[model samples]
Target: MATLVAIGYPDETTATAASLEARRLAKDLIIQPDAIATIIRDREGKFHVTTTHHPVGAGATWGMFWGFLFGLLFFVPFFGMAVGAGMGALMGKMTKGAINKEFQDQVRDLVKPGTSALFLVIERSTPDKAVEAMSQFGGTVLKSSLSKETEAELQEALHGEKSAAEV
Candidate 1:
């Protein structure tokens, strides 16, 4: 699952240093960096944070496209390319692009003033060390499950909006 560890600081330099330290500790404890946060400096010199996710391969998108193509081919009279594209897209999605994209989105949404958040993808059993290591930077904890829950929330939100419109 994805856990967002947020660190807030009064100044940009201190926050940046703390973020680096947190990163180092996370690395030392073998945390897989799913995403990264950035330090923002406002005109008042107060440090703020916002995170953006590094890009991963666009395999999942490719897969979705291929799925549509293959479904079309299978249903259509004679389109062999559809099936091949769909299969290729599925393979690409499974090879890290999908997970990485998910990670990036999670990291990007939470960055704001006075907070630098690191999004870490961890196994259920291995989160303790990462949590401990990252805490040294002194930030609030904003942990969210990185599984179907996030996707479920998205679905729920969409459905809610649609339902509201219906009313």
Candidate 2:
């Protein structure tokens, strides 16, 4: 059940500012609430909102691999320690390699101009405050949500039953 709510702000900074203002106005749709939402500001200065469902620990599963290698290296002795150290070094290099590649891609984007997408996990009740805050930045609010009928239709499709795609 995804609801698309639009909050308009004049610029990114203003939108960011409204996060503070929202406290006085709405107080519920606070940015960085629970560290659940990710704010992706693209080069065009548009805000993209993504709710992190399965956040892999530290650039994905690499965290666990590195952790295990260290555990083995520390807890084990002799050949085990040697093995741990070797594996640790290999895993560390591998982790660094992946991070570097990702950073390179990000670096290519560089410091983009204007405001990027400011993400927020808005509940059903705080729609008004979200709208108000976004508008403070001189932006427009466009609430996008699926109606009950639409939801039913989507559910039907999901169940592989019937759909309106025919007509």
Candidate 3:
């Protein structure tokens, strides 16, 4: 089962930077993430989401390929490609992509306007190492599926607290 974690940051830039760091941490085996999304609440209170994956583009590309092959039979390759790409893009937009909009909106409400949040779908991870990696870019935990104790420990980790000595 994948756990969702949303960490709120001061700004869009910081959230984006932290998302990149989290990706790097995943690559380093510090954290295992199924998906990572960045949500930015603009100055006007509008929310926008940024993702590393491009599902629409992928869908269009595949549609174009299939369309071209089918069009060859009808001698209307360009027309088929155009129609297929459009349809595919529409489908991609309508379908549920990687990011969960409901969860995103919920997290968005948790963050203040002009702030940003990093939403992650985690499969599993080494908590200590992942927390350490995120400590440098301290953020407030907006929401997470982690247990209360683990979440509190993560908060402490973000504050750079190492055991009782730091406190």
TM-score of each prediction: 0.41, 0.33, 0.51
Per-candidate RMSD, Å? 14.9, 15.6, 15.7
Cα lDDT of model 3 by residue, 54-161, tens digit: 233323432232233223212323432344434443334323332345644655455677898776645466444455567688887643354333333332322233
Candidate 3 off by > 4 Å: 32-34, 54-109, 146-167
Global CA lDDT computed for model 1: 0.40
Once superposed on the true structure, which residue ranges of model 1 sit more than 4 Å away at CA?
Answer: 41-55, 59-125, 149-167
The alpha-carbon deviation from the true structure for residue 9 of candidate 1, after best TM-score superposition, in angstroms, is 2.4
- What tens-digit string does per-residue lDDT give for candidate 2 at 1-167? 22334343434455455444544443343432322322334456443443323323222222233233223322212222222333344444433442234332342243244443232334344556555555646644444344444433332322223334423
Candidate 3 residue-pair clash tally: 0
Compose the digit string of candidate 1's lDDT tens values, residues 38-86: 4444545343433323322322222233233223312212223233343
Question: Between the candidate structures 1 and 2, which one is better when assessed by lDDT?
Answer: 1
Sort the predicted structures by lDDT, highest score first: 3, 1, 2
Residue pairs whose backbone atoms clash in candidate 3: none
